[model samples]
Target: MQEFFAMGGYALYVWSSFGISLLGIVYLYFEARKYHKKQQRLVRYWLHRQSKKKSS
Candidate 1:
């Protein structure tokens, strides 16, 4: 109810901290995915180069 939202008169601090933590988690998730994609691309590129070298 209202009391839950108010959070014992510390709603601003509590909610802001919670929001910041949520944003941080979301940012980390996207960053990790981006890093994973970049690593995959690098691996593919490395394999391609290795094959080229072997063929030569």
Candidate 2:
């Protein structure tokens, strides 16, 4: 396993790169969900307003 950990003396850098990529993916996922919810809310609001206007 020593050879595996060595990774040609670049284990630390390789692991750090993988960790940063994972964090970026997680951040993007939450941001995308928030954006989708906001869009849905805007659509619902517009539909409600249209219906109200039609009734008047």
Q: Top TM-score: which candidate number?
A: 1
Quality of model 2 by C-alpha lDDT: 0.96
Clashing pairs in 2: none
Error of 1 at 53 (Å): 1.2
lDDT per residue as tens, model 1, 2-46:
999999999999999999999999999999999999999999999
Give the runs in model 2 whose Cα sits over 4 Å from its true position: none
**Root-mean-square deviation per candidate:** 0.7, 1.4
Per-candidate TM-score against the hidden true structure: 0.93, 0.87
Residue 35 lDDT in model 2?
100
lDDT, candidate 2, residue 19?
A: 92
N/CA/C clash count, model 1? 0
Candidate 1 to truth, TM? 0.93
